[model samples]
Target: MSNIELNDKKIQILEVAEKLFSEKGFDGTSIRDISKMAKINIAMVSYYFGSKERLLEALILYKTSDLKLQIESLLHENLEPLDKVNKLVEIYINRINCNRGIYRILHFELTSKKREENLAAFAELKKGNLKSLETIIREGQSKGIFRTDVVIPLITPTILGTFFHFHMNKPFFQELLHLNTETLYNDYIKNSLTKHIQQTIKALLVYEN
Candidate 1:
């Protein structure tokens, strides 16, 4: 379902579902749990979403709606291609950091056999984001800033995979970096990690010859 189609009641249910699903895995979270937490009746949720799985699908669409706007805005900016790419990295890092819980839910659900049907929900979103990256890369290539032989498919994963690896191993990283406080961890993500991902992508895109 599109974000425009969601009313307050539907958004409330999605918000509650995202929260519960993040705290508890998709399989662990039920429609009743969402309705109870949302202070609504089960029938209302069922009427809106039909089932727990559909609710999850709706939540994915709702949460990512802003991403399209962000990418589109960035694309419209007149910055140099490489600079735009760096800003894109910042956007992605900030997005994942801000919505870590929802991403975690997606990760868990993707692995579970019960959530097979929901795998495609992210495909269109990923495709859109990938198209944005391709736009920037094409601009860079056209201007001789980036190499023509760039492996387009590897670019998104390189950025996202690096961030995901760090997120999944936050405890190890916290110990390794000695980030004892929540503030320190967040600061590291916002500063150190964001720059690192930007630089990594920069290296991947910059022309070698």
Candidate 2:
């Protein structure tokens, strides 16, 4: 086949595989299922991606970078620390609130054992984001704008983890907490989550710096 045709087919295969895997979980989806869903031969899946493991890697690579670029753009700006944090949270909620496919795929990939190269790539991405966050927290503390005791490493995960769990696990929370999918969770994401994170930081306030 032509190079363009080959590339398109590869993208098609990846897109289909990503959606199926996100919706069905890793074990629940198969190469044949991907092939059938893509309307291509099973051989094509193996040909383009080599193996199911590699396919999963490609999916992880695709999904993991969605928020990374956004974070990078925010960090490059001179916005205040508080605005930066809010923008990050807003982007986080906006992504999950709109394209749930990304949230689902990313959530699944977080549980998988990806290849070393993939892991390293993610570690670098994470390091950049963490550095941005740490920069903001440290700056805020220095400016007497935030509590000096607000630990980045400690609450960083809690803030992000809470955002991920609540935004990505909305369906389960609905089934578990009887949350109103249409209105209630949206409210919580905007008001409750944002406020909780802000208040958590407030606890470390030094008043006099």
Candidate 3:
């Protein structure tokens, strides 16, 4: 097969694995299950990812590759610290809303008592995002615009937990806010939810005394 076809087949397998993993959990999923779902032979799955563990690894890298790029690019932009924080909130909400399946799988794996070894891959992603936030916080602090006593560790989880909670319980939130249609709910997520997170983070970071 051509390189393009080869890449497409790999992605198709990854996408199928992501869906099955989200629904069945990682340990519950197998390479044979993925091949069956993807309508390809078991050997093809092995060829693409080698093993179940390797498949999950590839899925993590594939799904998060763009997000890593976005965060890196954001760090280089000439925006002010507060603007950078605000943009990061927008990015988080939008990405989480769009890729709930992968995030769900990651979350499950992160918290699973049976799967401690998988923590490294997820921790690396978390570390990178936290580092980006730390950079912005430090810049604001150095400029005397943000508080020196900022708790970076707590701040990172607060942003992620809040945004993830909102998206994970999206159906309940959609009903609570009376956003019946998907478009209405999406608008609230991108605009209202994004603004809320930005304000919360600003209150946490901005210097008062």
Candidate 4:
């Protein structure tokens, strides 16, 4: 469901759940914790979402709704292929950078065996995004702006993996690079990291033998 469809109560529960899930894993956080943090009755939580798994799915839907719209808009834009890629990289970097905690919860849920039932929703979200990226790549190929020999499945993961890897290793990177302030670090991410990802994707898509 879109953010517009979410009522105040649902939004409250989701915000609480995201914070708790980020601090404590999905398995570690309970419905009661969410209700308590949201200052609502336990029954209210149950009324809104039948179970914790369902609540997680709802959270994923809420967070990704805007991202889906952004990707669709980018796909329909009349910009050049590389420009589209650059915009997409900026989108991903900004989204991930802003929502690092929620993404950590997502990574935990996807990698761990904690909540298998809830994973279908997350998987579908990922599949839809990959399909959009593939569509962009196909459009580029049709225009002879991108190489036809590239493997489509690997493309999304490469970009995502690179960004996530850096995020997960933020402290190490900060130490290694001697970044002293959050502003400096974030600027590096928005500028240097963004440029690096764009260059990587463009190289993959346009490089010729």
User: What C-alpha lDDT, on a 0 to 100 scale, does residue 107 get in candidate 4?
Assistant: 70
The model with the greater lDDT, 1 or 2, is 1
* TM-scores of the candidates in the order shown: 0.92, 0.72, 0.89, 0.91
Ordered by TM-score, highest first, the candidates read 1, 4, 3, 2
Model 1 lDDT tens row, 1-209: 55438788888888888888888878788888889999999999998888777777777777876877898899999999999999988888888788887877775556556564564667778888889989999999999999988999898778878988998898999999999899999999999998999989888889666
- Pairs that collide, model 1: none
Worst 10 residues of 2 by lDDT: 1-10
**Comparing 2 and 3 by lDDT, which wins?**
3
RMSD of each: 1.9, 4.6, 3.2, 2.0
Show pairs that collide, candidate 2.
none
Tens-digit per-residue lDDT, 1-209, candidate 4: 22336889999999999999988888789999999999999998998888887888888888876787898899989998778878988888888788777788787554777565556877877888888888888888999889999898887778778988987798998898887789989998999988998889888989556
Residues 1-209 of candidate 3: C-alpha lDDT, one tens digit per residue: 11123388888998999899988988788899999999989998897777787777777777776787798799999999999888888877777788888887776564755554754565677788888888888998899899998888887667678877887788899889998999998898888888888899999989666
Point to the candidate with the largest lDDT.
1
Candidate 2 lDDT, tens digit per residue, 10-123? 878878987887788766789999999999999878878777767766654565566777877887788877777767667665655565664555445554544345445456
lDDT of each: 0.84, 0.68, 0.81, 0.83
The clash count for each model shown is 0, 0, 0, 0
Q: How would you order the candidates by lDDT, starting with the best?
A: 1, 4, 3, 2
